[model samples]
Target: MKTKITLNKYLLVSLLLPVLLFSCKKFGDVNIDPTKSSNLNPVNQLVFTQLRFAGDVTINERTSIIMTMPMVQQISGAYYNRYGSTYIKNKQYMSELWEIGYPNDVLNIADAVERTQSDPLKTNLNAMCRIMKVYIFARMTDLYGDIPYSEAGKAYATGIVHPKFDAQKDIYDDFFKELKEAGNSLNTSKDAVGQELFYHGDISKWKKFANSLRLRLAMRLVKVDPEKAKAEVQDAYNSGLFTDNTDICKVDYNNITNGYAEIRGNGVSVGINQYVDDGRPRVCNTLINEMKQTNDPRLQYIARAYWTNPDRLSDRLDVTDQVKAQVGLLGVDAGHYNYDNFLGAINIDYPGRGTISVPNGGQKAQLADFLVRSDAPFFHLTYAEVEFLLAEATVRWNLNLGGNAKTLYEKGLEAACTQLSLFPNGPVLTSTQIQNFKQDNQLAPGKELQTIDNQIWVALLMNAPEAYANWRRTGYPALIPAITAESTTTTIPRRFEYPLSEREQNAANIEKALTALGGKDDWTGRVWWDKK
Candidate 1:
């Protein structure tokens, strides 16, 4: 029964395929200004490239659930098909982003770069393409460890069906360099030759984005390469980065049929207008408890509690009537932990304790619209994130950044609060409320590093990949080990294993990569930057 109602994480792309085809159809057969069209010209090519960026960067609802959300503990479930319990061995889930991301997003950017390289007027377009390309490749390498960067997505011209994996360090070096050069090359006077998806053709905003990404990419090297990390912090700080949310890399769904919008708007998105709520996964307890402990207002943004007990479907309260009573359950393997454990975890209150729960007869809280809303802006980077990075940079390397760690930490929380307000309908954190949040969640003057890292983890709720990377780097948030950890006899995975399809088709390169990676390609293998 392949009904639309039963569609899950895997079917999202299948639904979008027809939309991709539909996108190619001519509008009224009049060519619709071929130079400014979505195909066969520079505008169209950049549009496609930007659309691809929207998809792979967690804007698409599918990967947001099955990949980043669960891995980072922002969302989870004990249900049969959710990501919480099945993450480590779910090779198909691990592989989907790679399969779709590289070919569609990376290759399109490459095409745009080629098409605009020689045009002096298209410098902004070409530079944006390069930065977007680096952003995509950075995500790829960060998640999967070493990846095909030098020759990836080049089957058309280079015919490199099996691109060899570049070393992660080398890939990161190139990414930083590309961002620096592209940020400098962006001509503020020369606007994009087309409809710019993120910042709307504002070249200054694009430069801010590039420099912000530099801060992000450099911060990843803090533990592994201190010298390089310090240098990057200095470089990025001097490059004139984002001071507010306006410059954050936000993907607007203005053109619905393009990149992330079409993919996430499909039948499988739980936030879809007609989506069924019967089997949707819930927000995880790890995040809920953290928010509850601080009396955080953002809980209203992330979760919607039940009006009546979810266990009683006959008398089930309309979701519309529910108040914001958040009850989050810790993630455990499906069928292994029972209803009793759930009830026990939820049926308690914490007064000034680190973890707190609001009981509701063992039911879990569904993710709020601030998360699942189809039109919610897909955030690629934020001013809060940069502030967090600067906070850490100041503390760790004693960098000469203007602000101290505490000020930057508070600013990060403020920006995160402001960012959530952008969601269509959510709890509003007013100026007073924001000030109270900062007051309540103040860092102990001595433990600045762990304190700042914990706040960063809380700030990065819907952002999965970056959160996971930070977890690997700093190891704050101190989550309980997975139930599967004892049986599998391993800690949480470090990197997603290379897809099995590569093993079958590109065996030679796969072998070389595996051998370079200490003779295994499973989750336990660390990336070059994860030496800590």
Candidate 2:
């Protein structure tokens, strides 16, 4: 009897152990405990991420967002120990957002999407997140012309170190399809869930955002398939899209202690050295003169007077005058004129702040002289931008907005003024300025498509990605190439070169992609929609 009892107890213990272990195990979802983390609240992080992305629209200014834009323009140059290769090679870093931000920041929503069981609680935000990924991934291919997509962001499980590039055409289709699905999934009736900085958990806003982006993507296909493009454009418009500045998505910066500040000072890649080396990117006369002609006051806000105090004794448009005088005429040794010193006359803050008592003593100048926090909301898409898009589209294909492209143009400029007013500096455009701007860029009946495209380019200043995309779609503005002694392709770089690592590590997969792509993986190969 005792032996039998003992055996029965042992059997019972064995049966229950698995249950206990399974119950005790942690798996499936990552629960974010707010009290334990030092990072900002989810609310703040979401907003900051958007700002960082938007601020990067200009290459080398705080944000590296427009790194690819300048690289394509051949305006890219080297200074200090740095070179243009960093910006040119940004395609490789596209995955960094997933590797770093996905698990760390955005995973809260991802987990919520995966693990939630309750109705209205199983986070629907995942689809929307994927919409953002569409932009990020599409941007990668937009720059590189072709890149791995289906296999991207899955390295941990697959052990696939390198992924093959996909044809730009297929990727474009996928982007459109994904965003369409994501937009459809934006049910405003669902419970407010996940981290949403731009919309504050507003599903309708997400729907609008998704649809607007779809229109932008559809417009990209205009050159390749006009019929399909028109169909998609109609679908986007019928979706009741974002029409006003209120629908415009942007990240408003907190007065103090935000992402821009942290990244501005704390980011290892940015700072005084970055400013001094790449600070030559300034407000060119093309933009400045246009604004000046309109009597636009925003010029003062955006561009501080470069030469606050040019040497009255010797002043010239180019830096060569200063360099020649400092080194040759002033009896300094050959090649002794540091480029950093040349920035001083332009009120450019160098490596450190304040006046350098000892001239040429090897102290770096403070770079506060460059573009810093104008303390404005970094734009994602604005009312002005959308109006311009519609205006150009109307002029090009005569798509349905009552054929009043002129009205859209006026609304766009008005919205532009309103958007500019949001900056801390008051009234960027005056009543007179607004009228003059309209008069100058107004499209006459039967105007060349190029005229509308050029005006759109003018409107997109500082919004680099949009400008670059617009340039690809319409090829307007006809920017003069850089005159510096640097060899370049006869045409602008159509797309980024595949990174060195992708070619070697994922050779088989890349070859498959090349075969699908008609046997050439050259950088100049146009994406499907780039038929123009």
lDDT of 1 by residue, 260-306 (tens): 43542321233222223334556666777777888777776566543
Q: Give the runs in model 1 whose Cα sits over 4 Å from its true position.
A: 1-39, 56-62, 78-88, 254-261, 264-278, 307-363, 485-489
Q: Least lDDT summed over 10 consecutive residues: which range in candidate 1? A: 1-10
Cand. 2 Cα-lDDT: 0.49
- Angstrom error of the Cα, residue 517, model 2: value is 6.8
Alpha-carbon TM-score of each model against the true structure:
0.81, 0.68
What is residue 476's positional error in candidate 2, in angstroms?
1.1
* Candidate no. 1 TM-score: 0.81
Query: Stretches of candidate 2 above 4 Å error?
Result: 1-120, 157-164, 254-280, 289-301, 307-371, 445-448, 515-525
List clash counts for every candidate, in order.
Answer: 1, 7
The Cα error of candidate 1 at residue 370, in Å, is 3.2
